[model samples]
Target chain A: MSVAEKLIALDPLALRADFPILAERIHSKPLAYLDNAATAQKPQAVIDAVTEYYTHMNANVHRGVHQLSERATAAYEGAREKLARFVNAASPREVVFTRGTTEAINLVAQSFVRPKLKPGDEVLVSTMEHHSNIVPWQLVCEQTGAKLVAAPINERGELLLDEFEKLINERTRFIGIVHVSNALGTVNPVRKIIDMAHARGIAVLVDGAQAVPHARVDVQVLDADFYALSGHKMYAPTGIGALIAKAEHLEAMPPWQGGGEMIRMVRFDRSIWNDIPHKFEAGTPNIAGAAGLGAAIDYLEAVGMDRIAAYEAELLDWATRRLEQVAGLRIVGTARDKAGVISFMLDGVHPHDIGTIVDTHGVAIRTGHHCAMPVMEFFNVPATARASIAFYNTREDIERLAAALEDCRRMLA
Target chain B: MDLKDLYQDLIVDHNRRPRNFRRMPDANRVAEGFNPLCGDKLTLYLKLDGGTISDVSFEGSGCAISVASASLLTERLKGATVEEAEALFADMIPLLTGKLPENAPREHFRKLAALEGVKEYPSRVKCASLSWHTLEAALKNAGQPVTTE
Candidate 1:
């Protein structure tokens, strides 16, 4: 069988066993965790890797010459290299460790875009970007006197490519796009977006926080100027993520922060900055998180990203079809391409009520604006109850969600 | 933690057809309450007469708990003196936060006690108390938005 068929045929229940938390019982019911878009449950391998790091190689990286520090440094740098390969970046140097995708975007906004922008210059973004992608640009625009322009999305939540192309003009300096919308699960045509931006001599930053967990991202293949992702959303620990950017941009951009390890030689008069990745990493990093993220990359690689993507596609399709059967239920984003996210609303039932009622059945889903309030405004909803799937989720989980939703409808009605 | 406790018939009824859910064109005091966590928002309008709430209403969108609590607040506040409303606020804050004294008399709360089950869900406490906080802002005549952080 081909790899796609092999992955599609894999026993999801067996894969579920790899995540120890999947066995947890909530309110005397088996846990049905469908909130992967918020953060994924870590596998045992990632947990062990984090535990092993603290247990054995618990030392500061890149500074100490001691044996523990050397081991720690090697492990941490090895993680950067692994992530570099995982995203198919040109070099590990292009991957700068960050607190998470939010911080990575903030860094790019402050260092790369802020200085280059002039008054009245426009930073283009989609209507479906998460707040992390929107707010930093707004802040930078506030400081630089630039304007943040939003490219509209269609009623189906897909980007209006023609309108987006129209929004890009001489005044547009940067384009920030979400690879997969956290609220809508719309897998944006990022490669096409990048090509369009590059043709106009504009830079593009892709928020891969929601995409990296669901699909393989090749920064080189996309020719993206900068890409950001959160490790926590990909079955790794929190407080660790990366920004992979082109070498030229990294070199051209001034360091966002000034602190130890990021500086090469400091003086009362002037300070020399460190290299590309290290210059951006200002403080003692999340060493344990890096180790866990490394193991997460390894775990994903072992299972194969292609397989995970294919399997999640199946799950997304199944969930879409299953959720459509419910009366008065509206699926928010019906983009031709999507990730493993389903944001829906039951008529006359508030999302918060849906969330609470569903939790009675031990079905965990996210119910809120999902940090994408603009998208909610576009859909004219205060919030949505989102059940985002992962590789370990089964059709049984979808059934549980549908049943819990029905219970919510019945109770609310 | 029981869903039944949280979503009582009273709450559902109030949420479905909230009492006093309209703009008061002749309002003396107005305050906006926003719960950023869930995007719940409410604009409270009150017409005070000689330290008494002569008329009160609210218009906004929020979860069931929020809308119900706001609806219930409006129903209880009408004809109540500012002092009595303030006292009720003092009593209601502790009750919703699960800090009510065990020996505290329940009769003072009356119908508003329907929201007591919200204490079981710590995250829902803000949803239940958002309007109360907004009411406090309106009573103080605070000209800024209130947030249930």
Candidate 2:
């Protein structure tokens, strides 16, 4: 059967059973969670994995020789292997865990990019980047006296690829951009971006916080110098994320933090750092969180990323048509190739008001700047209400969201 | 619970053609508040006399809720003292948020009570409160200009 037919035949209510939180109500109504872009709800398997780790094998990893300690270390390292396989990283050593994407970007900015960037060097980021992507580059530029340049996007939220190429030159040291825009769901052409930057001997960092959850991402295929993702965005718990880098880049980066797990040997006089991933991971890691992330990856693999992507794409196409039928409703990001995120604003109605009225019928969505202020500015809107979907979201959910939005329009009008 | 209770004819009328919805030429405090999360932005100007809000006007951009709420706040505080205005602003928290507050001074928020429609929209509570937050900041910096994030 075709993916759309499979999705149509699939009962999302049954799929919702996998997520215990989906059963709960928001504002005394069924929680119609359409805010997958912000953070996906965790499944029972991921929750169980985390709980089981804390219950049975809670101990500091790589430090102790006891049974629980060894088990904990194995589980932690096992998660690393799972992540390495998930993103097609060269080795587990290249996968360094941080708090989330923000910290990962900060790590790259401080350790990798900052030292290399000179006063006149330029770092090119896109207009559609999240504040996380924009702010770090700004910080690095501020610290190093380097210049931060923005590559503009077209009206449809597509990056102006030619303009992006123009931004790259001998003065351009690095190009950092979001693989998929969190606000507009504009899936960036990162392979071309990487190739363009690479030809000019410029490093590239792809913020994959949005893409990794919906799409099958092979960082190796992209050949990106640094790729970062948040585990929470992929149905895992918050506070755990990964940064995959080439082993050489990992080795070259100065240690981001100084503490227990990251240090090889410590003294008052001098200290040597651990190798690769350990060199970046400073504190006692979020071992249970990592285990949860592993479980999330396992769940996705079981479902199959290709199947999930196809199902979600069908949903996006369906939702796009459905939402367009609503009078006064205008979709913000109309990129030719995009993900399941639908950001829209109803004429004469505030997005927050729309969000509230929709929730009365138990339809949940995100309403805000989406942390991409520049994208909002590009659209000349203060904010928009966004509905992002996952594989589990059904056509019925879209109908309900549409119906709720219509009801909201009438009630407000 | 219905929008009718919050977006009353009077509030709607004011939102449609807000009174004193212009910049104050001789204003004591002018401030802007922006809720970056939701893209709500507002600029407020308050003319004070000793400790009382003598005249107030505003000009900015935001959603209807913010624009309406700012209109309501301006009308309610025209003749109110600083303490009374502050107390009224404090009393509006639960009404605008649609949350039942323990020991809420709901009686004191008579005119501002029109914003009860905002409760239905949890996300927009920030929009409705944007003007009040700016007012609070403007009140504190009554003699000097202020702004808020």
Candidate 3:
């Protein structure tokens, strides 16, 4: 049988047993954690890796001649190698450790974008990008006297490729787009974006912060110029992320930050910087965080990305159907393709009230602008209550969420 | 507490048919207040006479709590001396904050007593206080004009 068929054969209830925290309760009720897109729950493997690092190899990496330092360096570099393989990069040298996707995007914007851009030169981004993607490019453009351009999305939250194509011209030097929108969960055609940008000789940066945890992300297969993701959004802990870029691009860009480790040699007169990945990675790294991320990737690979994707797809469909059945509920972002995000507004109740009422019933969901104010503006609503799911979630969770919404509506009305 | 207790009958009555809620054509000081967090907005028009509040009016959009607070405040503070209005403002804060006991200042507060239930909800404190806070700033500005949050 095919792998897809085999994955479909496995029971998701059996898979839920692996996530220990899912069994816990909140507010005197069993936890119905539906806010996976904000940050995922860490698996035991990742937590164990982090604890084991502090317990045993508790030394700063890459500088000392002590045995502990050597062990720390090995573990840290080993994690980098694991990440490079996981993302299908050409070499580990092309991957740079960052605080998160926000810092990764800022690094590229400062080093690569600021130098190449001239006044009136345009950097194209989509309307659906997170504030992290939009604000950094805006600051870069403002600082360099360049202009920032936005490609508008359709009413259904899908990126209008025709609008994106029209926005690109001789003045356009780069295209920064999100692989999957954090607000709408609309998965863009990133491969096509990369190909189109390549044709125009414009580099493309894909914010894969949402995509990496849920989807099969082969950076090599996508052929994106730059791909950024946050570890915390995956099963890994925060304060560690990776930026995957082409080697040639890295060579051309200057160092974003200057510090001890990123330099090769220093004289009184001048200093020489280190090569590719090290140039971007300055000072002491998040060694423990890297180990945690390595373990998270291992846990994900064990489950198989295709299986997780398929399971999440089924969950999303169930949630969409169930939520739409509520009398006064209106689901936002009904794109032809989407991930496990359900943003909706109840007819008479404010989203904050909805969140409060839902919480009383033990279902935790995110409300308000959700750090995507512009998308809320696009929908012509002040805010929305969002319930985002993951592979660990079940159909019962969706039912709980739906039932809670009904109760909340009646209470508010 | 129940929703009716939270959004009391008095509050619903005030919201549905507000008193002293028209724009004052002969107002001396007018200011707009916006609570970005909840998206509640209001504009207050005050007609001051020397150190006394001569007349007060308001025109804007907001929720039941904010609208009722404004309507109740207008009735309490109109024709009162500036010092008395300030004293009333002073009493209202702790009363609405639930720092004072339920019957601590009930007879004095009268109609303004309706908003006493707001203190239980920390987030809605801003919503209940939006109009009153703006009125305080507007009065202070009329007393000695300056900038405020």
Best by lDDT: 1
lDDT of 3 by residue, B1-149 (tens): 44455567787677667789999999887777777664566777788898888998887755557777888878887887778877777788887777876566567788887888788767667767877777887776644322213
Q: Which clashing pairs does model 3 show?
A: none
Q: Compared with the true structure, what per-residue lDDT tens digits does model 3 show for residues A1-413?
A: 43334456676666566678888876677888888888988888899999999999879887999988988888888888988988899999988999999999999999999999999999999888889899999999999899998888888999999889988999998889999888898999999988999998999999999999998898999998899999998999999999999999999898999998899998989999998798888899999999999998888887888789888998899889999998899988878889868888888666766776687678988876767767877888767889999887888888998899898666555
* Model 1 residue A362 lDDT score: 93
Restricting to chain A, the TM-score for each candidate equals 0.98, 0.97, 0.97
Higher-scoring candidate on DockQ, 1 or 3? 1
Q: DockQ for all models, in order?
A: 0.73, 0.55, 0.24
What candidate 2 gets wrong by more than 4 Å, as runs, is A1-13, B1-13, B26-29, B46-55, B79-108, B116-125, B136-149
Better of 2 and 3 by TM-score: 2
Against the native chain B, each candidate's TM-score is 0.98, 0.85, 0.87
What docking grade applies to model 2? medium
Model 1 misplaced regions, further than 4 Å? A1-9
TM-score of 3: 0.88
Error of 2 at A221 (Å): 1.0
